[model samples]
Target: MLALQPVDTVAPAFRPEPVTQEEAAAMFRAALGLFGKWELTDDQAATLLDMPVRTYRRWKAEGPGRISRDGCARLSNLMGIHKALRIIFAEARRGYGWIKAGNDAFAGSSALDVMLGGELTDLMRVRRYLDATRGGW
Candidate 1:
């Protein structure tokens, strides 16, 4: 006879590591470059960054110094999405254009549209979708 012990079903609490100021600035720069590669307009970039258009412009012009925690998370997610796209699509053009290409998974909405919703989760959703496409999940 064997006795089975109940496994702990509770998930571990998520504790995100503190991002350094320099790291945040670098991520912001990378995210901006990604937006450029995707041919995103200023408005689109602002939306993705989850900031107003004016604030985005100011940050772009002045360069990021100490971005908020949420801003860092958003940029990190954007960079992750970009990396996933690059991995999934062998062609650089395809990877860049995939953001605007309609997807069945998003009810025919483009990944760009989903990401433009200005929420961190929106970026994560698109990244997860691309990751799954590349058999990452």
Candidate 2:
């Protein structure tokens, strides 16, 4: 009898590809649109984007410009979260409201609360949770 050996299946590190100026702007716009749909306050939006209130206001008014790589990553994760919510929930309202609704996954905290931690990891956590719920993992 021949002995079988186990195969290594470790995935590569997740390094996000560089985004173009237009792609970054488009993602920022999409995230802002989701913010409006979710009825998030200015403070909440600022927190979600990991930006100061003043900077948020400037971006809101002036429109998305050349944002930093971190900003692009944050917006991309938020957009992914929004997309995952829409995919998981049947109703549009439920999808939109889920952000503010308490979730057992976040220790009974709302997804918005977890996102308001003002860190890239917080946003990624919420996005990853939603993706997993949708079986995208």
Candidate 3:
């Protein structure tokens, strides 16, 4: 609250600033880039998109079978990979920072083992086979 000094008292007032079109586009780009860094959380994503969280939430809940066009490239790319991996390992057990399975579909020896265990020998074997076929070995 401000004490009333009365109008025409010869005091300068604070004025709000506005953005031009180019500036607005630049801001949109920056906001979208921020959306890519974090894990998929609705409110956080909305904040990155520069929308009020509740407004974003409402739009999402509408269930129109669509996502907004503002998803940044990094977010899209990571989400695509995550979805693909889920489909590939649908039957695999997940826990302790990795998923492992009987057939080891991902890393071919339980996901956790390959992820944490530096199994270069296993990697080399797979690479060797591919190399032989490609005539690069």
Candidate 4:
């Protein structure tokens, strides 16, 4: 006689921690660094971040205060795009320059041009494009 055992198919529940102000500030700082690498102007960076140029400059000079949920999401997407670029190109300069290089995927427009749309989905679209290009979902 043989006995059959049933395996558990349920996955454990996942609860992510709440985003803190300090963490959001840190992300903003990282985004600023990426902007510098991409050679984005203050106005361009502000537009991409969906913030006013004045606010962006303030944050750059003083510090990032509490970031909204949408703001956090935007920052995350921007960083994800940078990370995927880093993985796709061997040289960091190539990855940084790729943002301004024309691509057929964007109708001959650069990825930076696409992201400059100033919408969260715009940033997400760029991130997804880079992620898929680098064999990520």
All candidates in order of lDDT, best leading: 4, 2, 1, 3
Model 3: lowest-lDDT 10 consecutive positions: 91-100
Per-candidate TM-score against the hidden true structure: 0.85, 0.85, 0.26, 0.89
lDDT of 3 at 124: 36
For model 2, residues 1-137, the per-residue Cα lDDT tens digits are 99999988998899977999899888888878888999999899999877888989998999975789889889889889988988999898999988999989999999899988889999999999989889999
Count backbone clashes in candidate 2: 0
lDDT of 3 by residue, 30-134 (tens): 434333332236665554333567865665555222233333322233233333343444542331113234333443564323322323343334334334434
- Residue pairs in candidate 2 whose N, alpha carbon or C atoms collide under 3 angstroms: none
The candidate with the higher TM-score, 3 or 4, is 4
Who is ahead in TM-score, 1 or 3?
1
Model 4 residue 11 CA deviation in Å: 3.4
Query: Which regions of candidate 2 are displaced past 4 Å?
Result: 1-16
TM-score of 3: 0.26
Candidate with maximal TM-score: 4
Stretches > 4 Å off in candidate 3: 1-41, 45-51, 63-69, 72-75, 87-137
Residue 19, candidate 2: Cα error in Å is 0.6
Deviation from native of the Cα of residue 52 in model 3, angstroms: 3.6
Please give me the total number of clashing residue pairs in predicted model 1: 0
> How much is 46 displaced in model 1, in angstroms?
0.7
Per-residue lDDT of model 1, residues 1-137, tens digit only: 99999999999999977998899999998888888889999999998887889988888999975689898888888888888888888898899998999989999999999999888999889988888888888
Worst 10 residues of 2 by lDDT: 64-73
Residue 63, model 1: Cα distance from true site in angstroms: 0.3
